[model samples]
Target: MADTRPALPPLRDVIARHGLAASKALGQNFLLDEQLLDRIAAIPGPLRDAPAFEVGPGPGGLTRAILRAGAKLVAVERDRRCLPALAELEEAFPGQLRVISGDAMATDAHAEAGDGAHIIANLPYNVGTPLLVGWLSAQWAPLPWWSSLTLMFQMEVAERIVAKAGSDHYGRLAVLSQWRSDAKIAMKVHRSAFTPRPR
Candidate 1:
């Protein structure tokens, strides 16, 4: 079926209109390229009619991609400045996107996304490892609430998560990620891709 909803404005335009400069304190780096966002959203495989969760959806770039991929997305965003931009997305993809304005660290993601949901995000840099650790630790019980996770991290952190047992980067993160599930480096995004290049 053809999508008849009104088109959303470009992400850059939304950011400019809203005065949403990436906050270093929040570790935000917006991804403006829709095609790249689509590829990231697809890393976890088919999202059609499935539930998906996103953390820190600045200006709703990845959120748009996930909606386009046919997922019912529940996004937790800490920055209030981005809510209006995301609201635009909510209107464009009605009934497909839900925005929660609060710290992702404090949010009950599992409850919000429901069971068997896919967790995908271009995670905020500072909290990325902490969030992943929390999710990885959840495996101590039965199966995790999420069916899969396809998250973006700095190159160093990415290596640590998927490093082999004998590799130099191998340690706690690798153990946590590999203990219960098959974890792999799904993709590597270049530094320049971010709105403000991460140092």
Candidate 2:
């Protein structure tokens, strides 16, 4: 079947068109690089036709890549300013994308994305750690709700997550991240990768 979806505007153009300036209060850093976004979306391996969930999908960059990879995506965005842009994505991808407007911290991701969903996101910096902890400790019947987690965090937090015992960075997050599942830093994103780049 020929893909009839309309061509998407460049990420920067979309941001400008939508007036989406990354909000520091929200810990927003809009990722505009398509190749990079595609790489991040592929971190959990093949997601073809699988269920995928994204948190803090500012401007839907990663959301586009997930859908392009053939996953059915459910994205939760706390920033209403980005919803119009996301709605555009919904039109372009049709049934492939479903977006929820609310705080990811409060959302039951397992309920929204269902069992075995691949949870992937750039993750808003302010709430990333707490959110990861919640998912890691969800106490499911057999396993956690999601099959895998591919998330982006600030370098310090990432280091903490993969830190070894006795290391200064090793602590509760490190234990939780490694206790039940294989955890590793799949990639490192430079400050330049984000708009209004992190300080």
Candidate 3:
């Protein structure tokens, strides 16, 4: 099997070097656990030649994992502070990682990563719901541009994704997320897992 490891600075070191503090304004929380990131990356299977998209890849913890998993990636990060850190990953992976400097909320992920891209991200806390909703609102079934979306959302949002149609929590969000794929709680990520541990 090919090696699946990235040569880059440790997440904490990267954050420290960049003077990065999780910003409540941006809903940013740096997921520092490598094991958890690997699990998230595994959900999409071997990406092989398929392009992958990530939003708000703060400091590139999961970004590294995705590339190691053999994905050709286009990662959109709103914070310019992280560009240098992500740049290191781009260097490590050579041609594999393309870093786009922009807000994921306004960017069209499909257009950036192309059709049939697997969308995987830790997702910033503030925009996760709205971004997922926008992706779900696409005018087609099965989201022709997206292969699958493995993302992290707040507990309440995760509950709503898999909520049954008749349940009080069920609504448009449920319909939209589940219609294209079998949405499920892949894992539970606690606040303690974040670098700043979002409240």
User: lDDT tens string, model 2, 1-199?
Assistant: 9975468899999999999999999999888999999999889899988999999999989998998888999999999999999999999988989999999999999999999999999999899999999999997445677899999999999999999999999899999889868999999999999898888
Question: Higher-lDDT candidate among 2 and 3?
Answer: 2
Worst 10 residues of 2 by lDDT: 137-146
Q: What is the lDDT of candidate 1?
A: 0.91
Model 3 RMSD in Å is 1.7
Top lDDT hit: 2
Model 3 worst lDDT window (10 residues): 136-145
Decreasing lDDT order of the candidates: 2, 1, 3
Query: Rank by TM-score, descending?
Result: 1, 2, 3
Error of 3 at 143 (Å): 4.6
| TM-scores for candidates 1 onward, in order | 0.96, 0.95, 0.94
- Mind giving the per-residue lDDT tens digits that candidate 3 earns over 23-77? 8888888888888888889998888777999999989999988988889999999
State the lDDT at 111 in candidate 2.
Answer: 94
Candidate 1 TM-score, C-alpha based: 0.96
Whole-model lDDT values for every prediction: 0.91, 0.92, 0.87
